[model samples]
Target: MEASELVQRFVSRMAEGQPIHTASRLLDELREDLIKIGRRSAFFESQGLPLQEAWVGIKFGEIMTFDTIYLAAKAQMGFDVVLLKDNVSVQFDITEATDRNVDRAEEYRSGPEMIVEDSGEIARQESLFEKNVGNRLKRKSSDNLIVYVNTGWLPEEKFIEDALIRWHLSFKKKFNSAYLLIRGSVVQLAPELQKFSNSRSRENGPKS
Candidate 1:
């Protein structure tokens, strides 16, 4: 099928039903694009994430539909999918979502903690999130989004909640929003994260 037709199908399916579920399908459709960008086996290995498994790509379920839709559209349009194992962001030209000039997005996460308990893995991932925030923020995006994907073992709700709290506490002000892909589901970080960001700006008041 032509890329345009595929993009159209995506838009149609999305408009007809639950966006949360639609987003997962959209990601699946673009699986090839994900793998294409992830072809850099050497790069993933350099980062210490098992290159063999890295190309498997991330997954998302049905937590935050709108966020998923936004990401799905971008990914479908062909944003560069970089395997910055500890971080994921997207860079793209604002062009039509056709096959020819398409690309994907970037997602970040710490290398999986195979031996550690869930708490330890969560804490370690959180630390990686905190440690990488500054560097990820440095890459300016007109879209102003900070996106991350958790590659750890099955992420539970508690992990999501805790990680979001940390995100609000840490990088809330620097980016417009944070999107997380956990267990094959895409979700926006807490709304309060953005609210807190605005609050901080007000408290600090404009820098003179």
Candidate 2:
């Protein structure tokens, strides 16, 4: 099925107040399948294949994350959604997943840095952030700058916190708009800085 059709069916079943137990299971299966299809389709399109070949190559697991988030937002809050490489931004409404939803908060927090580790991922995320921010300033940027950081793997909280404070102070001195959405423990931001700094140190090699 086409992505749109699949989304519609999923939403329709959901709106009917179907039992979460059964519906969620089905949704999970369908979402995984659809995303795999979508990813294959995207790959084929990139290869300049004909539309039919692209469609046939699509797998749902590849796009399941985007679709599930979109559907959740649509069903709960009626928000119009747009998908980017690392995050999904909602334009018309933001009620579905507020800052308080730990899951959404965690996603906004960690999703960006996860993208930053790889050059390709960084370029993709940067393009999307730029598109979302447009003419806006960076720090006062509000919800426009969410990224994932893989906080689960980092070290102690204090170490990360100190790093974030130092980074924030340095960045703020240069540009007040240097804010970022850090994921993982609330302390992951500092560790991310340390991670980057450590990587740079290794690249620069030993002091004289």
Candidate 3:
């Protein structure tokens, strides 16, 4: 199939159906893009998230359609995906905060030259979200921010909650809400931490 057809397939399946459970099918359809992924595939592989799954379009297909939260894909202007339910629609940006500072997902699709100053600095000077959030925050969180916090980038349970709490609190401008995806469990952390909000406060710092 042509490259354009692959994208069309992705749109047709994900725009109206349950793509949450259909990740593999989308991966297969879009697998050719893996060859395009090329050099950066190793970095993603080391992170334990294969190029097929980590690819931008494929990631959108997965974890997007499992619940009542309907995701209608949008253009670059705003709201990467819009939530539709009943008679209301909410804006959401499905973004990633990976271990590496670069937005490799966009690089893969747009074919830009990537720069890596120091691999040793990965997640050292700042948390995953902090490094990448600066650009995304230009909108200042008008749209709901749904982040895929790659495991290599962050940590488990409480540690992640703490990082998110610290990251969210540090910024005067913040997301309408922030949701973190770690190890298959989805945790909402901003505006509120669902269960942890009461225990957390701006003064609290994340564990190093």
- Candidate achieving higher TM-score, 1 or 3: 3
| TM-score per candidate | 0.36, 0.27, 0.51
lDDT of each: 0.35, 0.31, 0.43
Over 100-170, each residue of candidate 2 has an lDDT whose tens digit, in order, gives 23432232232222223566754554444333322232233222212222223232334334445555544
Per-residue CA lDDT of candidate 1, range 1-208, in tens?
4443444554455433333344454535544433455433223223322211212121221222122222233435443222222133333212111111211222223224344457876687556544443244345353334243333333344544565576565444554544443333334543344211111111110011
Winner on lDDT (1 vs 3): 3
Error at 112, model 2, angstroms? 16
Tens-digit per-residue lDDT, 96-207, candidate 3: 5444445444333321122323545533424544555434444445546666544342233343445557666644246667665443345565676653222111111111
Q: Please report the candidate that would top TM-score against the real structure.
A: 3
Comparing 2 and 3 on lDDT, the stronger one:
3
Q: Give the TM-score of candidate 2.
A: 0.27
Over 4 Å off, model 3: 22-24, 27-29, 32-73, 83-89, 99-129, 133-139, 157-161, 168-174, 195-208
Ranking by lDDT: 3, 1, 2
Q: Which candidate number would show the highest lDDT if scored against the true structure? A: 3
